[model samples]
Target: MFENFDDILNVDDVAKALKIGTSQAYKLVRSGKIQAFKEGRAWKISKLALINYIMNQQ
Candidate 1:
């Protein structure tokens, strides 16, 4: 639903997109394996960074 690069996606979106668990998505963000930024009390991941990570994985 979020299409802009400036938009931030929450853990649930990332998990659903990547087909991973919510806990795993949080772990990736916390561990620096995936890029995320803190917005208020929540973590937000950039669409660009997520795409880059997927590309690199392949």
Candidate 2:
């Protein structure tokens, strides 16, 4: 997980930053593993959420 990022990031950015596939990122968001909200057909993940996810991973 990355700490430096824009306030909000898209699935594409999350996928690249987390080194995971786009679908995997989506799955995380859909499964409530990563905090995110859907906008139309896209998912927006927050930097704080990503940080929380990383912290909780251990």
TM-score of 1: 0.82
* Ten contiguous residues with the weakest lDDT in model 2: 1-10
Residue 2 miss distance in model 2 (angstroms): 3.7
Give the per-residue lDDT digits (tens) of candidate 2, residues 1-58. 3656788999888888889999998898899999999889878999888879988999
Q: Could you tell me how far off, in angstroms, the CA of residue 19 lies in candidate 1 after the best superposition?
A: 0.6
List of clashing residue pairs for candidate 2: none
Best by lDDT: 2
lDDT of 1 by residue, 1-58 (tens): 3363345678888888788999999998899888888988899998877877788898
Q: TM-score of each candidate? A: 0.82, 0.85
* Alpha-carbon lDDT of model 2: 0.87
Pick the TM-score winner. Answer: 2
Question: Over 4 Å off in model 1, which ranges?
Answer: 1-6
Error of 2 at 3 (Å): 5.9
lDDT score for residue 10 of model 1: 88
Which RMSD does model 1 reach against the true structure?
A: 2.8
